[model samples]
Target: MKKILLGTICLMAMAACKNEPEKSTQAVVAGESTKAPGPVEFADQKYIDMGKASLAKFASGDIDGWVSGMANDVVLRWSSGDSIKGKEAIAKYWKDRRMNMVDSIETSKEIWLPLNVHQPQSVESKGIWVLNWHQVHATYKNKQSLTFWVHLDMHYNSEGLIDEFIQYVDRSVINAAVAKKK
Candidate 1:
């Protein structure tokens, strides 16, 4: 099942990028010139970089490094309808429950997509928002393993710190895995 899901995600990603225009070193604006100006950069590259780095740290079980990218007042909302506010509380929650329960986590696949919306308010926002699709393989301390998909919608503040993180995952899979161990 995990292999099937991973394969499907890979196909989807390939199909999504198939139709994209070939990137050139220069972006033509107002039909200026054929010569490229310079390498184009994504507007949200920094936020994406920070997010990827945080995920890498999490995958490597570096809880401290992962939490370091968050804002002091970061708000984290879990799919189980629990909300943790402030960096300290979030760290404690993870350390007590999550980090302790899960022996290790490995990301099988990740895709970062822009928030597709057309609104003036969204356009004028001070921060950038990204939706990340993550397929993770988690192993519990009891040696139980589960592969799950998580959707994370993260908002980065102007200082490039994650201010809001909304995680969507099916908790039943994890619950069942734990129940089977008992």
Candidate 2:
């Protein structure tokens, strides 16, 4: 009788242990263990398609088409310490450059490669960001050529338009190309 009671108690304890939920080893924000972090998500095909379309518009020298993807109050932050605010400002900036300096934009050798995209699941306030590695080849009106690599980050607004555009590049290459004319 005692042996039967002891075995029953041992079986109950084992069953209780098995019913307990397992804990995850993954890290979470604010030490909250209720939710485990998910794997990093890459840009979907839609984002890639949008990026390719925007690049195509740029390559074709369609300033209006390129600007169409941006929000009305878009902010452009360049690595060269230039900040352009508003869609109108961006349009004027590009128009000035196209009219004054650039002779043609070559897209045959240009490449815009999507590197990574991160959308934090825990952070609700943070928006999605995409990293694009670019290789731009352009020819100046003076027949001088410039080719450089640029890193671009784009933040999309809730309306699916690009709200913030940031570029990282070595401007010295462009400056040298311009200085050659002088």
Candidate 3:
């Protein structure tokens, strides 16, 4: 009985397939894309060079050189939601911190990526953005040392100067290290 039922099912399936029309197997013709063009991101070596030079300057205590490519009204943002605006103020703040608190800053394993956004999306401006990742070994003036990784993003304006800067780092470790007394 089971074998006869199986034979009947197979015959019914074959009849149904025989009655259906064959489908075309031709490849689809290509056409224009329907999606709107999104942001265009590409690398430019000049931005990478600038980013590296700035970091080198900072590590060597060249505050002015480090900020030379920054716009007069540039803004610096940290991962902690704290921010500092204006070139002179930023320079002053970094200078004071380095001069008073830090003894040395050494960076290694540097990686730089430069991106040019020809078309931007919401809240994003069209410009050149340089991203850098490095390890920082810092020694405080009180003879305390701490090593950490840092990620920096800098956006350049039409003048090829950085107008906005963002840094992603955890300062809590450094804060604790600094708060410890010798």
Candidate 4:
């Protein structure tokens, strides 16, 4: 009878402890902002389609179509710190390289992601941005071929036209390959 009574008392004590609220173990830092992160909108289909179409136009030698979606004051920047401003200048640059310099260019393993950034850092603008990654097989006019991965970020203005394009790639490898003679 004593053992039964002791077990019942232990169960009652455990039940009382279980009714207590849990205490947080996380330490609170002084002056730390408890702000929540900004909202992120993912996979806007139109931007993805536009990005894919732009790349397709470029690979198929349709320079005009590729540039048609760009804003009038578009800016294109390369990872090598080279930049081309204005839609006309960007078109000219692409024409010269695609028509005269490159014989054939093909893209594989392409990925496109579109996002609307509700809030961004000070250096970034809040708008639609499309991110692309692809493996390119490019043949120079000199018959030299190179296959490399490329990353590009295209920022679109409110009118759904691309205003900023940033291309990230190793320019040295491309320059060396282009400089090679047949």
Candidate 5:
């Protein structure tokens, strides 16, 4: 009985915090101060679609499709300090190396996206969380399946589109999986 009661209380607390405006280290999404260049609309369905499309393409190893899905002037911070500005250059990197290092890769994008609704008008982020994707079993060109977790410190744009895409999968997992062959 006590355990059940405690669980219920914790559940209520978590629910109450769903919309509690936090993670303002960055600004809100819809802070359109009446004058900002290309002020993006917050909670934009279009943006979400773009993200969903990009995620699908990446997971599927569709390099061209993934690049096409991003905004022209994309500001990508893939890691804590490794930031890649502009979609064109980023595209080149993907084409050169990251595109087909593997023959195929699968990810559970939607199932892993953060489901936080703690903000105003979709422009303001009530909070942020680390998005941990399901295990990705990627098959290399030689048909070797390497399993790893794709974790992202996701940031949503004004359109509720993920402007910044970061990947935090443990490379060691891939290394170990591949090491077994050699």
Candidate 6:
């Protein structure tokens, strides 16, 4: 399952990036290793740190805190086909982004805690896999359910901050939590 998912994401990335971020794998000369990282440099430690910081702030709804992390001119496209650009646009999009749930509804933390830990992904020629889709299995409350990994592909921005996210989790788990109201 994991192998199949990764193969699919690789194919998709190859197709989408064919006309875009066309695989730029330059030879790492001795002199090039010492230079500082650019804003969109996702492979470097700094880029990962900045991206994670932005996500942490975004999750907390600290707009002022995370806004600076984004580039002035940025474009965001959702799987739903809503495309937005610029800082103001991003801010406005975030305004109503909060989720409200009933008493029986579960917290995101509850669902995520079990699925968040993962093995490191190898760096390919292109960008890193920001949200590698893996599987999560659940049984009874007292029973110990295990995870069998699957491939889920998610995309982020050049700055390393996640501008997009799409995951293929267990359909049963996702539908129970995100199904439209009757």
Q: What would you estimate as the lDDT of candidate 5?
A: 0.59
lDDT by residue for model 2 (8-123), tens: 99999898888557877777688365644344444455766787788788767788899999999999888888899999999888888887878777554334443233345563
Candidate with the larger TM-score of 3 and 5: 3
lDDT of 6 at 82: 52
Q: Which pairs clash inside model 1?
A: none
Number of the top-ranking candidate, with TM-score as the measure: 4
Give the alpha-carbon lDDT of every model: 0.77, 0.74, 0.89, 0.90, 0.59, 0.46
TM-score for predicted model 1 compared with the true structure: 0.69
**What are the per-residue Cα lDDT tens digits for candidate 6 across 50-169?**
545555665465766766655566555544455677767777666544332222211132112111212333522244434333233423222333333333333335565444444343
- Model 3 lDDT tens row, 8-89: 9999999888856777686665854555545775667988988988999999999999999899999999999999999999
lDDT (C-alpha) at residue 21 in model 6: 55
Work out the TM-score per prediction: 0.69, 0.69, 0.77, 0.80, 0.52, 0.38
Give per-residue lDDT, candidate 4, residue 72.
97
Judged by lDDT against the true structure, how good is candidate 6? 0.46
Q: Candidate 5, which segments miss by more than 4 Å at Cα?
A: 1-50, 79-81, 98-100, 113-132, 159-162, 175-182
TM-score of 3: 0.77
The per-prediction tally of clashing pairs is: 0, 0, 0, 0, 5, 1
Better structure of 2 and 6 per TM-score: 2
Best by lDDT: 4
Better of 2 and 6 by lDDT: 2
Q: What is the total number of backbone clashes in candidate 6?
A: 1
